[model samples]
Target: MKTGVMLSCLGIGVLGLTACGGAASSALDSYKPATVNTPEDAKRWAKNASAPNVYLSSTAVLGITGLNGQGQAEDTTCPKRNQDGNTLWLEGDCTDSEGRKWVGKARRESEAAGSDTGRFVYEGFGYEGTDTCGGKEIAGKWIFEGVVDVTGTEEEIHFDIDVRTDFTGPDEDADCAVSDESMAWDYTGTVVEDGSSKNTWSGSGRVGSSKIGVATVETKDEVIDMSVCDSEAISGTTTLTGGSDTVVITYDGATDCESSSTVQWSLNGEAKGELTGVSCASAGSAPAWALLAWPAVMLLWRRRSRDVRGGRGRRRI
Candidate 1:
């Protein structure tokens, strides 16, 4: 009888251990990390960074990405200037890192669609200090000021953006800012589906805010699927600020994630009005710890099960 009890106890212990292991695995799956759907979702970040609907941050990437203008994808860096109650003035030069560069100024209104509005301005520069086509000087700055409906969720964010661009210059000087160009967009985002700590974002928008007599404006919102979270550094993929009008830009500069913890940027999907990118990282260890506790619980359960089985077996024997 004693031998039978011992054997029963051993079997129960083995089963209990296995159960514990299973429990641990389950706990690990339930773990959740500190997540950010959009590292600096242009709208969300601007709201959080700006004041009470006065001036707001100038989204260089957002501005260019959502633009239905002509040219390849490139970076346009701007300098921070002064900010009045609801108006911000920024003056900077742009060097097309990967594409071409043009001089321009953009303004973002702090009000929603049906409320007050804002303005944006831009002036295209001559390539070699002179206009090429028809020897016509492309002068004057294109200006845009309008209202927008910006709405989105934690996992899925969307934007319905519309704006008007104009060009005006000396008609006799062969340079002018032409009005009648408009760009519109509809965007969507999905969180944490593409990678461990990343989200995929893409959207479509009209081109033109294009020139009337000039080339057609490519009205497509470029895909922006990028990992935009940075925990260790002050300046990385994501940046922080106090009010809406004050703008400070930074870079994530993380291309080779293996060498650096910083997340890199990439492009995905077709260019028919939208683009996408991915951001992923090593998951946190909290889940691993949670899973560790299950093994102990299962061991105890097995001991109890074995005791009950032994008692019944002995009584029958």
Candidate 2:
């Protein structure tokens, strides 16, 4: 009887050890790194990393108020304006350079009328009518709010602006597909006169019918010269986090404006590998908001070199 009882205890101990080992193996597998072993993986990482910068520059190009004819939207007419004590309300309609109609309403402090610093809170801003893209009418909306501060002389004016934008649209992937796919983004950033920006953005909803899950982008002192047709970030590092993966991109700050960037990726804090010669230009090419919003908003505040002392049209550094 004694020998039988000892054998039974030994069997229970072995079963427990087997179950524990299996559980540990599964947990380690879950922490495996993302696929970053090829140049293609680097390209994909670069694209996602630079997306926040594109969004930042595009939003700056939209300006504080779309009423500025210098912006992408032109021929703005505000038919209604009401002043109630310290608050001012405005409603207007405008046509973008692409012929798409936009109707928006805003409220600002009445004191901002003649001030160089103020805030404009957009109550409603987006496409007013059928806006077609890729032979199909696309529906989307932009919720934007900004504060603008201008200082210095007109000859050498300086601008500092803070902006927040939220966008929701069909996740057609620029193909004009008919599906329930949709994507949404919430981003906020700041732009200064020197064309340097910092941005933090998060994505939700879906990307082409597949849930984007948890994704975010954070940029640090990113500088871009949009005047250049093939512009990419000239300097700075952008960190992009998606699910269990993290990608870090560092721009070479090449004076020639070449698309020289490096991408390093990791998963769950495990270092995977790194790649060079990654092109960040693709960031502007196909962002989440690329289809209906970003293309029209493609512009940036021209950066002026501090050493160059001349008129507005002079050479930039």
Candidate 3:
């Protein structure tokens, strides 16, 4: 379905490039609906309307932290680092085999340098890059600031993150059919070693040229079991509203890591559709922009961790 294609294109920018083009058309700032006269109509509207949840998930926030849902660094492209007194500066450019390019810089300060216990604060961390996938080329930028606190002998870790992103691309289909396309969002969340997390997201943008107007995403406590799943919100609700029509999506909780989840969709207070299996974490999901954008920052942290703790890695708390 074009729903997956829309997500794949958005995923191309998660860790992507600079914003070089005009801002997405403001006309896409509000939802403009197609006629919904049948269950099929409601089904299509529900899928497209609820698609943004994929990008709004905690997984996307983790992408900004340069870590996957599994709390592992998956990107190998590292940015250059320079040590300046107690502060470490990272700046450089990297290109992946897929021809995606990333350029950015970040500043981090060590709270307790040369001590067995380590605490770091990341300031002014951001990057921009671009990638082409599923017949679309996306360019975007990401900016974030957070603190990583490590305490005790086991070196328990905890982090609070805030992130902002702006991405622009042609909203198109597999055949290269162009439509309205753009996305921008703000995401914030926290992850602890116990595999629990909470997130809140809000944004106004377009997916596959479809206007999302203003939307907010939220996940319940322990809704995403990091030990069992990779950033999928096994239980949560996302609401999208424009004019008098509204769409709501509910993700049914699961027990294991599954590619798809059971979801229910409703429009204007009426049930429209229910699907037993909906892919939410695959490479082709909406966070594909993150897959491409996060590597540069991920590489930076991987290098930093290697230089510290003598190869003993820090678990994401």
RMSD values for the candidates in order, in angstroms, are 30.2, 19.7, 10.9
Runs of candidate 3 exceeding 4 Å displacement? 1-78, 85-87, 93-101, 108-182, 190-212, 226-236, 254-259, 276-317
Q: How close is candidate 2 to the true structure, as a TM-score?
A: 0.46
Which candidate, 1 or 3, has the higher TM-score?
3
TM-score head-to-head 1 vs 2, winner: 2
TM-score order of candidates, top first: 2, 3, 1
lDDT of 2 by residue, 1-317 (tens): 00000000000000001122222123222332334333454344345334333333323323323322223333234324577765666665655443434556665553334443233345444343233435555554444344333234312222233333334432223354332211222333332333233222221111110222223455565554454423455566656555555656555444545544444444445655655454333222221111122222211111111111000111111
Model 1: ten consecutive residues of lowest lDDT: 7-16
Instruction: Report residue 163 deviation for candidate 2 (angstroms).
Output: 8.2
Q: What would you estimate as the lDDT of candidate 2?
A: 0.34
Q: Write the per-residue lDDT of candidate 1 for residues 134-252, one digit (tens) a residue.
A: 34433233233332333333343233333222333222212322222222111111111222433332222121112111111111111222343332111222222222222222223
Worst 10 residues of 3 by lDDT: 301-310
Local accuracy of candidate 3 as per-residue lDDT tens digits, 198-294: 3222223322223333333332332444344553445556554444556666665554344555566677888866753333322222211121122
| Regions more than 4 Å wrong, model 1 | 1-80, 84-137, 149-155, 168-317
* Candidate 2: count of backbone clashes, pairs at least 3 residues apart or interchain: 0
Deviation from native of the Cα of residue 126 in model 1, angstroms: 16
Ranking by lDDT: 3, 2, 1
Candidates in order, TM-scores: namely: 0.25, 0.46, 0.46
